[model samples]
Target: MPGRDPADRSRRRFARRQWARRWLAWRYLVAVVALVAVVGGGLWLVYFSSWLSVAGVEVEGVGLLSATQVRQAAAVPQGEPLARVDLDRVRARVEALAAVRSADVSRKWPDQVLVEVEERVAVAVVEIGGRLQGMDADGVVFRDYAQAPPELPRVETGATTGSEALREAALVVSALPADLRARVDHVEASTIDEISLQLHDGRTVEWGSAEDSELKARVVADLLAARKAQHYDVSVPGQPTTSG
Candidate 1:
C-alpha cells in the first residue's frame, strides 16, 4: 500500500475538525431542548397539582362591613385553585351586597385571596312603606333606622322604596352643603315630580324637582344666609322666595 500524501492527511484532519464542530453544535441544541422540557414539565406538575389551593382569604379596607360578612359576600371557597377563581365575578357579587359600596378582589400568591371592600357610608335614613332604613348615596338600604345618625340628614320620599327613588334622593343629599346637610331633618319625595326638604330649624325647602339639586341647594343656602327665615320655596329655578 502506498503511504498517504501530506496534503491528503491535512485534508482529512480538517474534515474531522468540521465533523466534530457539527456534532458539538447538535449536542448543544439537544441540551437546550432537554432543559426546556424539564422546566415545562415541572411547571405543569405544580400548576395541575393541589399544591396551589387557596389556604386563606384576606380582607382589607372594611369599616361598616364585618370580615365574616365580607368573606361571605365574596363567596370564594377554600381549597379552590387560585388560578380558577374569578376575581371580577367575586367583586361584582360583593358589590351587590347592600352594605358594600365597592369591592376589589385579587389573588395572593399560591394560597390566598385578597378582598378589599369599601363600605357605603350612610348619608340619610329613608322611610319606605313606613319602615325606616339607612341608605347611602347609591339608594341601597343598608340597615334599619334607629335614632337618626348625628350630623346626617333624614330623607323621606314616596319614591324612596325603589332603587330609582333612592338614587335620586342620594343625588339630592349629596348636593347639599356639608354644613346644611347636618341641619336637614327629613326629605320628602311624595311624588316623582316633586321633592321637599324639612329642616331641623322648623323651616321647609320646597325643592320641586331633583334636577339641579346642587344649584337649588346653593340658592337655598344663600337665601337662608341673607335672611334668617323659616321657609324657602325654590320650586321655580332662578327665582327663590322665602317666608317667615
Candidate 2:
C-alpha cells in the first residue's frame, strides 16, 4: 500500500491521455466555431448594415437640366445598401427625362451614388400652341421654351412636331451653310416632299425633298449669285429656276 499499484498507475495514465485528446478536439471545435462567427458577422456588416448604405447622391453633366431635377428624376433609393442599388433602373429613370439624351448611374462605394446625364442639343425650334419646342437633329421635340430661341432656326410644323415633315425641315436647316443658315428666317414643310426655306431677306427657296439637299444648297448659292429674285426653286438641282 506504500507504493502505487502497477494496474492503478496504468489506469491513471490512460485517463490522462483520454482527457488530453478530448481537450484537443474541443479546442479545434471552438476555433472552427469562432472562425464561422467572425465570417458571418463580417458578411452581415458588409451586405446588410448602414455602414455601407447610401448617404449622398451626386449628379453630373447637368446643364439644361437642373441637378435637382435630375436627382428627382433618378429617384435612387435613398439610404439603401450601396452594393444592392439597382443602377440600371436609376439610369433608365434618369433617361426618361425629356432633356436627357442618356444617363449613367453607378455606386461610388461606402455611401454615395452618382448619376451622369447627357442632354439633348437643340438645333431648331418649333412653335406649337403658343409654346416653343426645342428640336434636336433627330427631330425630337425635347423641351419647351418660353420664347423662341433667336439663335436657332424655326421649323413650321403646323399643329404637330416631329412628324416626317418636321424631319425634312430639320434636315434642311442642318444642311445649310453658316452664312445661308444665318439668313434663314424659318423653314416650312407641309409634307416630306414639300420642304421650303424662307430666308430672312424675304427671299424664298423651294427645296422639294429631303433628298439632294446638299447639292441644292450649293446650287442655290450659285443661283442667288446670278440673279436677285424673290423666289428660287432649286428643288431640282439639275434644272433650277428663279422668278419674282
Candidate 3:
C-alpha cells in the first residue's frame, strides 16, 4: 500500500480534471439551448401571435368616398398579425376604385392598419356613348356623372377617348382662367395641333397646338378681354388675327 500511494494520488488528480472539463462542456450546451429558446419564443410572440393581430383599421383622407368604402376596399386582413399584413396588396385594392387617384397603407402597430387615399378630381367632362365621363388633368376618364358639371369644360374628342387630340384638348381646357373657362361651351380637337374653343355665346377661338400653351393661354386671355370677335385666331398668339 505504501509503495503504490503516489500513483493512486496522481490518478485521482487526472480523473478530477477530466470530470471538470466534461461539466463545463455540458453547461455551455445547456446555456446555448436556453438562449435559442428565449429568442425564438420572443420572435414567435411578435410575428405569429394574436396579441399583435389587427383588431381594427383606420381610414384617412376620404372625401368623395365614405370611410366604410375605403375600409372595404382596403380589406386589411383582420385578426392577422399586424406585422404580417401585405401593405402593397392593400394599397392596390384601394386604388382599384374608380374614384381613388392614389393610396397609402401602413401598419399602426399593436392592433391597427391605416389606409390613406386621395380621390380623383374632375378637370373636364367628356361625353362618350351618350354618357358623361369625368376627365382629370392627366386625360384619365376616372368618373361618370348623370349630368355634366357646369363648372368644368366639356371636351369633344369625338368617340376616341385615348389619343393625342384628347391630351391636347385636356391641356387647353385645364389652362383656362376662371373668367374664360366659365364662357367655354365646348372644346373640339381633331388633332393635337388643331384645337378650337367654343364660347357660350357661339364664338370660336382657334387655340392651335399644345406648344407654348401657357404663353398662348395668357395671350388668349388678354385678347378675349380686349376684343369681342366672332372668330379669333390665337394659334399665333403674338400676332393674333380676329374677324366678326
Which model scores highest in TM-score? 1
For candidate 2, list the clashing residue pairs, or say none: none
Give per-residue CA lDDT, model 1, range 1-114, as digits (tens). 279898998999999999999999999999999999999876765555578878888999987778888888788978777778889998998889888878889989879999
C-alpha TM-score for every candidate: 0.83, 0.76, 0.79
Where does candidate 1 have its weakest 10-residue lDDT segment? 157-166
Stretches of candidate 1 exceeding 4 Å from the true structure:
1-18, 21-25, 159-162, 228-230
For residue 84, model 1's alpha carbon misses the true position, in angstroms, by: 2.6
Instruction: Give, for candidate 3, the lowest lDDT window spanning 10 residues.
Output: 157-166
Candidate 2 error regions (>4 Å) = 1-46, 159-162
Tens digit of per-residue lDDT, candidate 2, span 42-79:
88877798889888889999899999999888887778
In order, candidate lDDTs are 0.80, 0.87, 0.86
* Model with the higher lDDT, candidate 1 or 2: 2
